[model samples]
Each structure stands twice: as C-alpha cells, then as structure tokens.
Target: MFTYEISPVFILMEEVVLRKMHSIIGWPEEDGDGIFCPGNNTMSNLYSVLLARFHLFPAVKTHGMSVIPRLALFTSEHSHYSIKKSAAVLGIGSENVIVIRRDERGKMISSELNSSIVAGLVPFYVSATAGTTVCGTFDPLNEIVDICEHHGLWIQNDAQWAALLLRTNQEVIHYHNRLQRAMCCSQGLLQECNQLCAEYLFQPDKHYDVSYDTGDKRIQCGRHIDVFKLAFEAQINHCLENAEYLYYKLKRTDFKLVFKGKVNKVNFFCCVFSNPATQREDVDFLIDEIACLACEL
Candidate 1:
C-alpha cells in the first residue's frame, strides 16, 4: 500500500548488497534520518560489522591491532564487497578478507571452508550470505553458523534481498483475504493459485512468544519504529497466508513472469506483458480503465 524511494546508492545497496535491524517503541528522532538508520542500505547496516569487531576487541578502538593477534575474515565469494569495505576501513586490510569457494548454485562450499580453516588462518569473523547476489542463491547457513560458532568467529548475515521476498508473500496473503470476504467482484481468478498456496513458509509454524525473535541481546542501538512497520509486517505475514496469488495470477493471464515461477524467493519479478494484438494505445487505455474502475468504487 506504500512505497519509498530513497537514493540510487542506498537503493542499489539494499537490492544488491546489505541488510537488517530495529526495535524500541519510545521517542525516536523525527524529521531527519538522524533519528535512526533504516538499515535498508549497505553502508548503514555495515556499521554492525564494525561494532561487532570493536566489541570483541575493545583495544582495537584506541590501538590499531597492536594488542590483538593476526586476524582474518571469511565470507563467500558470492557475497557483496561491503564486508571487505568494512574491513578496509576498520584497519583490517582487504587482503585479510578471504573468499571461500561456492558451489555451482552460488552456495558457499562448506568443505572448502574447512580446508581454508585448516590452512592456518586466524579468522576473527565469518560472514554468511542467507541470500546471494547475481544468482539469488542462498548459502548453507546451518553449516556456516556451525563452523563459526565452533571457531569463536563472529557471524554476520547479509539478508537484504531476502527481506523483499517477505513483501511478495505479504501481498498475496492480503489480497486473498479480501477475495474471501467476497469484496473482489471479478476476483474469481484468485482461486487459480490454490495449488501454489502454502500453509507454511520454509519452517513449520508453531505458537511461540514473538519476543524470542530478537533475543540475541547484541550491542545494537534501538531504531525509531518506521511508519511502515505495521503494514509491512502484515505484508510479511501475507507470505504465509496467500503464497499462491501472484504465481497463479500470471500463469492464468497473458502476462509472462520471468523465471517462470522458479525462484528460491520471489525477489525481482520481471513481468513481460507481451501480446501480439496489444498496441501502444492499449497501454494508456488500460491505465484509464483502471482509474475509472477505482472511481467506480
């Protein structure tokens, strides 16, 4: 129901690079971004990396690597350069940022990582990509997290693009509820996706206290709850309720969706509304028709 356009750099960072954060219901900074970081951009979220490292070794603040031993950072080859950039800025030269090999599907090869660890590298941190760039594949977080925990390595999850998938799910679930209320006069097409509907997302749904979601208790500063919170949260939940709407909508229509409904999570939905009989005039007419229909309501 709402959209925001920040900047080319920030938007591109969110689309292709970084991710996460938020909490606290108190007085947040107003009128300026000075209040809180959306963490929707690369640079904004990268601050967490610096914070984690600094917290691990407080001396790194006043003294530059004088007290700490030789340290390295490991991340997947498919990961964004944001980690390396943070390293470079934090006095850990880019050379210390090791790139682990990834499999054909763009997932980090855990075996290769084991070999790297065996090769005598003292890693201070290991970043895992929950969702990757380019191929939109996800690295094996279970393996990566296990490795990092065993080695006392700080883990960072770049889950920016994954957040968008939450939106697609939200839209479908919301629309379907409206249809069930019989509010959609011409929405019989909504049922076309009943097969695609999913009762659960990747994990089985269980009734648990939601407070446990952010119980990590990391040194994260509270963010001003963005105005988009409630609606977007509803949209995120929509993923669970109406997972089939978009897939079935395009399947039953003349429009062809890129990727043909095959995506780990629907990130970039490139739709080609190509039709041999459609004319340039039809585009404007369709917009007019939609406007008139909206007015009819």
Candidate 2:
C-alpha cells in the first residue's frame, strides 16, 4: 500500500552513479546495467538470487516456485548469511542453500564446492565471496568461476573491497574521471527479471527517454534516492597508507596478528583508516590504549 514519487533529477543521479560504478568495475560506461537498491549488499544479494531464479525459470515470476524444479544455491561457509536469507525470502527455502567449505585462510575451497553440488536438486546459483566477513581473505575466484562454468550455474561475486577502496575522499578523485569500456552483464538480466512494466510510471509515450525510469526494475514500490549521498568523491591510497602505518604500529605493540607472518597488505583490523580524518597520532593512541587494556586484563 506504500506509495512514492520518482523525481526526474533523482533518476538522472541514479544513472550517473550507476555509470560511475560500471567504470569502477572496469566495465563499458554505457554497456552494463545496474540499479541502486534502497538497501545494502544483502538486498543486492537478494536481487541477484531473484534474478537468477527468474532467469532460469521465467515462469516463476508469474506462476511461482511451484513451476520450477527444486533449486539449489551455493556459497562459502565464510560468505555472508544473506544468501540463505535470500533463499528463504524468495520461498526457495534455506535448506537449499548449500554451504561450501573454506580453507585455512578462510577462502572457499573450489574442489569442495564442485563436490558439494549434490544429485536431484538443480544447482542454479553460486555466491562467491571476494572478501570474506571474518578473515577478510579473498576466495579463489578463477577456480570458482571455472567450476561454476562447468556446472552451468549463475555466479554472483559478493565483493565489498571496492567500498573499502572508495572510503576516502582522495581515492575517489583519483579514479573519478578515469572511465573505461566494460560491462556489468547483470544489469539487463536484473531488469528483465524484475521489471513489472507498470504503465502508470514507466509510460513509453512520455516525452523524455523512459529508460532512465529505473524504479520499475525494483521489487519495492517506493525507491529511495540512495545515489544522492555518493555524489562526492573519495581516495584510497591515503587510507591504505594509514592502514599500513597502523599495521606496523600494532605489530610492535601487545596486539598479536591473527595470522602470523610478514605484514604485507593491511588486514581487517585497520578498517579505521577508511575514515579520512584518521591520522598517525590516533593510530598510536589506539595501539597504546589496546595494549594497556590487554595488560590490565
């Protein structure tokens, strides 16, 4: 029963940001397609699963899950729980979401994933975690992709690293104008899967190009102007530098690395550097305070 109006300006902003995202992912500026969801990555995951379901069984949109065979989805044990949540929300049932094994470094074991695709259930989707939630280890994407290709499963890469990379104001500017040609490939699929073609809002007879009216491509009636906030730019190198500084500082203090060895890339604990305001003095104080608290324990 909820209702909302989509402004022309809001539609323009969405188009700009979607194009920016495509460029960031090294896709053609005008080639790929996507929609900015009112929710976070979890919602996006839901959309991805919904798209996969609809893609494989178009009748599911009109006829429901009863029309299709029992479907199975695969994800790493270390991946976000949203995959199962998506399954449950879509009436696919959480039991159908198969959990793949992860290695010592918390990366998904591709071999285990290949072997996990059991008999009877039609494996339609696989969610690959790029940066895991706990250990922040990246899954072996190439190997996983090969397996998914072999099984003819729809692959969705859950990557949050780009958000971390674009957290700072400096890095945002660095990559701002650097546009390239590549494709998301999923955008069109998403539109095809979810579009209701409501004539009231998405009237093709309108004077302006109706393609920018992307609200129909979503499941919800009210679409928020989420792209408004991303209008500003940010940087990554400065944040990475800050992370490296904290990494060495933490090493010298009472804090022990969760995984021992040389500190190469900044680990998950250095997320504070995402804030551009974080300075060396703050990092020093944090390290000292944590060490002091540890000693008191």
Candidate 3:
C-alpha cells in the first residue's frame, strides 16, 4: 500500500503512533488494497534490517509448517532504545538480544562485535546508529558492515537524523554493499531516485495473485507514503541551512557546545539552564526567549 525511499547517512532518535488499518495491506514495491499508516522511516529501517537478517541465516529459516523465524539482534549499549523495543514487539526474546560494548565515542567496538559473532552468537542482525540523541555520533558503518559480511550477518544503518547524506557534497561510496533497502522521508530525493532507477530497480509482481493470497510479510504491510513529502519539503525550504544558522548563533552566544552534528540538526551545551539546582523561572525565561526568536523566523 505504501513505499519508503531508503537513505544511507550514518540514523531513530521518535515515537510512532500507529492507527488501525481499514483493509489488508499489499506489497509495497507493488500495490493493492490495504490500510496504510505513515510509519516512522527510522523504525522501518530498523525493521527492514531485521527482516533482511532473517533471510540471511539459512539455519533460522521457518520450519516445515511454521512461518515464524527465530532472530537475534545486536546493537551497542549507547544505541537507541528502540532496538530492544523492536525485538520485544517482533516476538524475539529480549534476552537473546546482545548489547555490544562501545568505545568512548559510543561507536560499537569492532573487536567486540566480531568477538560476539565469532563466539557463535551468530546474530542474524547487527544495527549501527548514525546519530544518537544524547550525543550525535556516528558508528563505524563500513567496518561493521565488513564484520557482518565476514560472519554472514546483515547490517542495518540507521540514518534517520543524518539526512544530510542528500547534500551535494556528501559521499556515500563507502556504504554501497547490498544496501538495496533504505528509508527516508524526503520527497524530492525519492522522486529523483524514481526517475533515475525506476525502470530497472522497481517492478510489480507479475504473480501478485499467488503471493498476495497468503498475505505473507504482513509485517511489511504498513509502509508510509508521506515520508518522501516530508523530506522533500525539509530540503526545499533550506531546513538544513536554517538549522546551521541557529547552530552558529547559539555557539557564538553565551551557551556552550555540548554535541554538534551536521547543519540539518544540531544541539548545544546549556549547562546553566539544565542544572537541576537552577531556578525553574530562569530556565523558563531562556526557553521562552528561544521560542520567541524561533517564531520571528
């Protein structure tokens, strides 16, 4: 019923509220009758990665009459909490999920990840975050991908916040290994991709009748259509430029630089207002001032 354009910025740091579907959803690459929900692209990326991992492990395949596949996922301790949440929602035992250790920058240490896999954990899925909320940091995507490849694991890169991968100056040659599926909410890029790769990349299932009959991949049913529109609008409006403006302005101001990333999104270190011992009115005043300034623009 819907499709998402995948991105690779090296990405969820959002809560998604799902509404009821009016009908059975169909294949996203193709189309049919179904209720559609605007899924969070980040969540979709996470889910797809897990699904891809399922297809990688032959031993984890569905048994004779069962369709459920046992999956084990790996993520860093500093990674987003959604990884665990997704595992729980997907019926995978939370205990089966392994939290890989990370370095000082919160990037999962390659040795640990490899060790876990070599130790026969054989996690079918490994996720690396591009940007974290507490601190905007990128995990080593290429290296992790290599490790996954060596061990027959599928890797998913969360590029939700690092939407800047669309910038003209961005370089993604380092991340092009079997990354056939990705997710983005940028409309302009999706349209551009459709124009460039539409003919060769996407095709409707000729045997939709057979595949659609069983309603397989019901997990893939709720794809979102508006993600592209949102991304397009953000880029068209120079959203990243405006973010840069605020970032530079705040950095030059009395505030400190806590954590910073690309122009598309940035955060500042405001120890003064964030201190719990600080007076509430003072924090409120600062917040109000920022809000007023934002409204003026």
Q: 1-297 in candidate 3: lDDT tens per residue? A: 222223111001010101111011112322222111144344554444444544553333343213444556788887777777777765666776889987765678888987787454336878787765555577888888889888777677665455334322242434533221234222122232222223332344433322222112334433334324323433433544544445566666655454333432445442211122344455446656976887799
Cα shift from native, residue 241, model 3 (Å): 2.0
State how far residue 274 of model 3 sits from its true place (Å): 22
> In model 1, what is the error at residue 3, expressed in angstroms?
27
TM for every model, in the order presented, reads 0.49, 0.82, 0.56
| Model 2 lDDT per residue over 46-150, tens place | 877887888789999889878999999999888888889999999999999999887767788999999998798999998886566666777787787788888
lDDT of the candidates, in the order given: 0.48, 0.69, 0.48
- Tell me the TM-score of model 1: 0.49
Superposed model 2: Cα runs more than 4 Å off: 1-6, 24-26, 29-31, 163-187, 228-239, 261-276
* Descending-TM-score candidate ranking: 2, 3, 1
Backbone clashes in model 1: 4
Comparison by lDDT, 1 against 2, better one: 2
Taking every candidate in turn, the Cα RMSD to the unseen true structure, in Å, is: 18.3, 5.3, 12.6
lDDT of 1 at 167: 37
